[model samples]
Target: MRELFTDLDIFNAIGIVGVSLYIANYTALQTGFVRGQGYVYPTVCLIAASCVLASLMQDFNLSSAVIQVTWITISIIGITRMYVLGVTSRFSDQERLFIRHMANGLPEHRARALLDNGMWLTADPGTVLTHEGEPVDHLSFVASGKAKVIVADKTIATSGAGMAIGEITYLSGEPATATVEVAEKMHLIRFEADKLRAFVQRNPDIGAVLEQNMANHLRSKLVSMSETASRAPVPASADAAAA
Candidate 1:
């Protein structure tokens, strides 16, 4: 071990660090901790490439130098494209909200692509967003409104801004679990079910984020239902039946 350290110059140490970073980044990417299109992905790769190139100055290797340079160039291009095209400063108010809230863990460009597939509009009070026992042909994301979750004509819970409607049956191609009625006028981005499903199928990463968002929304709705149920008075019919 002491003999090995004898040849380990500063440049070799830098090279080792760079190799470690490469392995770490690849591991993280495979584990889904960081997305390939996200800033961290290319940024880390760029740093690793730079470190490797710096080490090559101490001990020259033509092939290794060429590879490192190419890696650095690709990383720079990726980073530049992400910044130049995914300029959040130019995004509209709703797009910003979607990015901040609904598009969790997705790259901004991919989020925008998903957003482009939908139609943004305002829905009025008493509007039926989804019908219970009917196919959910569309999914609505509530941007700024509240809706009642109705099951068998009883309002069981409320879904507010940042929640998705008709998500329960989205992936399964089943009937909606409950009807959703707009209790307050709301801004919504509506996506056609067929198109959304196809888009998701084609983009698995986006699909994964969508599923996560839906899961979070569903859990919140469940909590709301639990609270509402806890507050409800015992029905007179139940007492009468017991008597």
Candidate 2:
């Protein structure tokens, strides 16, 4: 048994270990134990690929070496991409809050990915976000300031920061029921409806989160409207009859 164990045996053992690591990583990902896009997954893959390459050095096999090299390259690329995304998507406290209603509970990278689909812009007071009776082509989130919801030249509701604009129309596949006009100088993140729909289709998890957020937002709006209605004074004509 001692004679059977040589330097070649040790190298072969390492190669076997490397193969085991690679398979384990893949199985973990396939079984949903690990996220494929996460840092740890790719890092493990990189280490496994390196070990396999080292083991191949003892007894050169061109095909095995080539596979190991390719694996290493792919793992390195994945690591780099993960790192870059992490660095670029770090958000400030206020910024995170601004997007929280829509992206709450999402993985950091996934939240960042959802935010990347929109363009940030500053709008002056009176800027029309959506025209009444027009097709809804985009959705916007108010990061700061306020907007007025107008229908047929009458203001109906006021939307403040953290509120969603054009969401109702965007979801309903109908023309804008009201015109959304900036009531104060505002910063907003706007996403093209078609592009956003495509992205949602591609990433169902993010899409699910977004739908939940929208539902919550709508519920809050309904509650607010109900409270406002409850507090409103009755018209004098109606009061006169009661008196």
Off by over 4 Å in 2: 1-84, 92-94
What's the lDDT of the predicted structure labeled candidate 2?
0.84
Candidate 2 on 121-146: residue-level lDDT in tens? 99999899999999989988888899
Between which residue pairs do clashes occur in model 1? none
Write candidate 1's Cα lDDT for 1-243 as tens digits: 999999899999999999999999999999978878789999999999999999999879999999999999999999999897677536678777766666777777888888999999999999999899998888878889899989999888888877788787886778999999999999989999889989988887898898887778778777878988998888999889999
TM-score of 1: 0.84
Q: List the residue pairs that clash in candidate 2.
A: none
